[model samples]
Structure formats: C-alpha cells, structure tokens
Target: MGLAKVSSFLLVILFLINGGSSTTFTIVNQCNYTVWPGLLSGAGTAPLPTTGFQLSSSESRLISIPAAWSGRIWGRTLCNQNETTGRFTCVTGDCASSQIECSGAGAIPPATLAEFTLNGAENLDFYDVSLVDGYNLPMTIVPNGGANGVGKCNTAGCAADLNGVCPEQLKVTVEAAGTTGVACKSACEAFGTPEFCCSGAFGTPDTCKPSEYAVFFKNACPTAYSYAYDDGTSTFTCSGADYVITFCPSVSSI
Candidate 1:
C-alpha cells in the first residue's frame, strides 16, 4: 500500500512537470457589459490567446498555461465597428431612402464603449464605440478585388462600407459591461436563415460585435466591392466607401 501511494504521488508530479497543468479563470464584467476578445497577457511583453477554450457568460475559460508565459497578466481591449446588419440605413440617420443600405443584424456596435484601455489585475480596460455611420479608410489598404477595402472610420475607429458612406454607423456605447446572461440565441432556430428586424432609429438591427467577415461579396468590379442586400435591389460599394475607427489598448494583431 505504501508503494502504491508513492507511485500515485509520482504520477501527479510527472503530470505537473510535463506542463499539463491547467487554470480556470474568469473576468467578470460586473458592470453589465460584454468584454470582447477579452485578451489576457501574463508575464511578458505580449499577451496570449485564451484559446482551445470555452467560456460562459458567468463561467471561466479553462486554459493550458504555458511554461514560457511568465510575465504577469498584461493585455488591452481592442474593438472597432463594422458593417450593417441588412436594413434600410444610411448617413444623416435617414431611413426613408431605398438607396440607403440597411441591415437587420442586431448589434449595438461600439458594443462595450469605454475607449481603449488594458485589462489586467493592474489595469481594467474600458472601451466605447464612437463609430458613426460614415466612411472607413484604413491607412493600410487591402482591397478585396472590388471597391471592398479596409479603412478607418472618421479618424475614430475602423469600419466597413460600400463606398462614400457606411452601410450604417458602427455604434459603440460606454455603459458598464454586462452579460446577456444568456448564450448566443441558438443561431435563430425558426425558419430560413433567421432574420432580425429593426425597431426605429435607422431601420437596422443592432447586430452585436466581433463582426465576422463574408467569404464572397454580392458584387466586386475591380474598383468596387459590395455586399448583397434586400432581395437584390442594391449592392454596397467599397470604393470611396470606408468606415474609419480608432482603438486604444492597441492590438498588434489587427
């Protein structure tokens, strides 16, 4: 029995030495907000991805701590606004124009506004989306064939657009961050691809953030790139079109 106990203790030590150790951590945005891509940096100049992990609104992410990650938790929040959900929206807050590209994607862009800051035991970052529906012009341009291009939004933050004007402003708010207390509503499980509608304001849905990218645009004409919309009545252009954005707690990996 003593030999068996000794064997078990040695096994545990081996596991620890093999770098199979794990830690469960939680960053509660007790402020009634959502901290996106909540980056975590520990013991180094750069932060690490809390990846291969799953997290719940109230749950923590289980991460495999690397031996090389020794610095302390050092990371900043980085977010910018992008694209319209698919509704009738445009500049000047006008919803009466069919020419205006709209979206039903419910996202309040600037999702958790408080402006760029770091989030760590030493620093709790804050952000607020200030991207209004306008242009997106990134200093570093990467054209997607057509007018589709990356740009900055009003010198404030990053944004996506069809051209000239943004499909809609990427709104960022500054309210305390909090969880919906619910998981992402099961991918709209009712009928055809779920379709969210807008109440008033800009005739668009407040599609929340971490705006994903599209694999193909409805159209792209060398100098122009646009996304599909409204049963195909019009397409968003990415020519002079751009949405600019400014973010702090700067992300080196944007």
Candidate 2:
C-alpha cells in the first residue's frame, strides 16, 4: 500500500481503539401507565437518534450513543395531544416542543433526570439520577458490562415514588381523574429563593446547605441527588458500560 494509505489505515485503527465505539442505552418503561421520554444532548455534543418518543407500559427502546457523548434523559407523564391544533404536551416533564420530539429543548423543571457524561475524565462514564429539578416518577440507571473504573458501577436513582408523600408546598397536582399528585417540586423550583436554588449569596457549596425539603428527598432516596450540592453520594462512575434506564422500576428490583 502507498505510504499515505498506510498512515490513513493506522489512524482508523487508533480511533477504534481509543473511544470510537458507541454505547447502547436501553430505555425501559415499567410504569403501569404510558410514558413519553425526552432526551437532550449537552451543548456542542452530537444529537441523539431520536429526541423523544412514547413508551407504553412494559415497552422499551434501544438507542446508540456515540462515545464521549453527554446528555440527560427524563420521562414525561400524563401527555396528550390537542386535536384542534395538533399540539402535544405533558403534565410533567414537558419540553414545550408542541410535538412528541423535544428537538433540542430540555425538560421543564419538576422532572426526574438521568444525567450522563460518557467517556469523560479518566475514561469513566459519570452518571446520576437527579431530583435536584424535582421528582416526577421513579427512575434508575443500571450500568452493565463495564470494566472496573474509578468509582463503583452501582445503580443510581430515586426508585421511590415521591409524589404521594411530597410536602403540600412542593406538590404538583392534576385534576384529570381526581385531584392527584403527579410530581414534587424542588425547593428552588417551588420558592425560587437564593438558598434553595444555591444561587446568588448561596452559590457556593459552603454557603448552601440542604434544607428540610432536600432532607425529605435524601431520606427517601439516599443515592439520588437531593439538592444542588448533594454530590458526595449521588454520582457513580463506570467505563465502557451500556446503560439500562428504567422508569418506575420495581421496588423489589431496586
């Protein structure tokens, strides 16, 4: 082969050996009701194959994620379509896209989020299920088939249903069937205060401390992020792992 062609071949081999392979995300919906899952790639990251889609109970879908991709996934509940205007919307975790696909829009607050930073520093994939935005439904991230990395590849999520026990001040209710709590709001989302939001005077971790509301979530799901600075126990790391993200995972399995 020509020298240029040989060099090109060598580069291709190097790319495949060093983070060129894609990762698979298997999204499962175990809720009794339907769920509309939304995905948003981080700024400057490549877009995913599909931004949003519907998943009936017991249904699942597989998505291929390029190496080094970073993004979040969340499920929308109580979604409906407006026949007159052909608009789509959800009671919780709506992306405001007016369609099933979120396009590039992120979830509205009060949504449970499974955030991922794949192939990051030290080639570890950092992941966490966050209620820092608030809680909508039970969700978990289970890493599979990863080589031992910096941190344990343990499951991370808020598998407990927080809506029913949510504080009245943080409850989001819908009156469709009757008055029902569908989601719980973070103190920041509920009150917009500097302390709850960890902003302004409370921007630093030293100044911002978990409040009563955050403590409620922490007590319920010790491994999930309960507030802006609840990082010590919330984050998990793995390398070259395919993820299984399940919404409304069974308590016994969690």
Candidate 3:
C-alpha cells in the first residue's frame, strides 16, 4: 500500500477511537415563551459556529462542538430590539453585545449557566449546571452516548422556577403589566460581601461556608452548584458524549 493510504487508514482509526473527535449539542427551548441562547467559549478555546440565537418555545438547534472545547451556555429572556437605535438587549442573561450574537462576551449575572469542559483530565467531559452565578431560568444538561466516568453521567440542573419563590431582596422584577419576578439573584451578587462572594478572607472553601441564602438554593436544587464551593454533588463527568441542554426543563423530565 502507498504511504498516503496507510496514513489515511491510521487517521480513520484515530477518529473512531476518539469518538469522531467532536461533540454535538442540542439546545432546546422548552419554555412557554421565547429564549435566546448565549454561548461563550472558555479562554484558549475556539468559539463554536454560533455565539447566540433565538429559540421559540418548543424549538431546538444543533451545534457541533470541537473536541477539547470548553464553554458556558445560558438562556436570555425578555429580549427586545429598539427600532430607533437597532440595539438588542435582554432582561436576563444578556451578553451586552448590542446584537444577537454575543461576539465573545459572557452573560451578565444573575444568569444560570450550563458549564462544560470537554475531553479534559483522563479524557472525561466535566459538566455542571451552576446557579452560583445566580438564576434566571430553569435549565438542565443531559449527556448522551458516553462511557461512565468516575462521576456519574446523569442529568444535572435546577428544573424549578426559582423567580416566583426568590427572596424579595434577591428578586429581579420587571414591570411589563405589573411587577413580576423574572430571576433570582445569588447572595454574592445581591450583597457582594466576602462571606457571600467567597472572596477576601473567605476565599478558601474551609473559610467560606454555605450561608442561609446558599442553603436556600441548595434545598431547591440539590444537584446544582448553589455557591462557589458547592462541588461535591454539583459536578458530573462523562466520556465522549453529545449533550442536550434544555431551557425551562420540567422537574419531572429531569
């Protein structure tokens, strides 16, 4: 056989061994209203094909993610474009890009985030639905077609709508027709104290213990990362899997 033919054969073998060297993510909008999904690639990782887009209720989009990609995905709600200025903005999870695409910008907290680090240590994909940033909407991450890693490849997220039950002080309200809560703010974002933010003297896990606010989130969403150091039950790992991210996921579905 020719040298080129041999090289091609080896490449095919590697592709099969590495599970095609890419992952597919299906982003679904299960909410009763519209949602704009924003994506931000992690530092040193290439951006995906899209940074942001709108998804009407029951709609879904598929994105191909390169191997070793790391990023966070979240949903933006109550978006509008000003006709006079042509500026786009959202009430929650806005990336502040003035356009549909985030263009390398991240969601301005308090936004729930679905975080991922694909093909990481030991070739495992680490993922979690983090409320540590705060909570704008119910979200979940479900892994498909992956070998079980040290951590279980189970569904992870907060499926409950926290806005209605959010503390008055941490509630993000909008006055469309009347005052209505749209999102819940984390204690760190609401107060900005070292004890809550996990900064300064409380930077370490040992020093920074869960507060009453953190406990509130944890009690509502046991599988999510409620605070900065809520890792024990928050993180999950898988090997070579496509992911399905759903916004406003039903509690029973999760």
lDDT of 2 by residue, 170-199 (tens): 999877746578999999999999999999
Instruction: Give the candidate number with the greatest lDDT.
Output: 2
Question: Per-residue lDDT for 1-254 in model 1, tens only?
Answer: 69999999999999876644433222322112222322323334233454212122333333333322322211112222335643333222222222221111112221211122223222222222222211122111121222223222112222222222212222222234342111111111111132311123324434421122111112211111121112122212222221222222122312
Writing each residue's lDDT as its tens digit, candidate 3 over 36-132 gives: 9999999999779999999999999999998899999999999999999999999999999999999999999999999999989988899999999
List pairs with backbone clashes in candidate 3: none
RMSD to true structure for each model, in Å: 19.1, 2.0, 1.7
- Full-model lDDT for every candidate: 0.25, 0.94, 0.93
Decoy 2 TM-score against native: 0.95
**Reference-based TM-score of each model:** 0.23, 0.95, 0.95
Residue 39 alpha-carbon offset, candidate 3, angstroms: 0.2
* lDDT of prediction 2: 0.94
Candidate 3 C-alpha error for residue 229, in Å = 0.4
Candidate 2 residue runs with Cα over 4 Å from true position: 1-12
Candidate 1: segments with Cα more than 4 A from true spot:
2-6, 17-20, 40-68, 71-254
Return whichever of 1 and 2 wins on lDDT.
Answer: 2
Task: Give the better candidate number (1 or 3) by TM-score.
Answer: 3
Per-residue lDDT value at 178 in model 3: 59
Candidate 3 wrong stretches, greater than 4 Å: 1-4, 14-20, 148-150
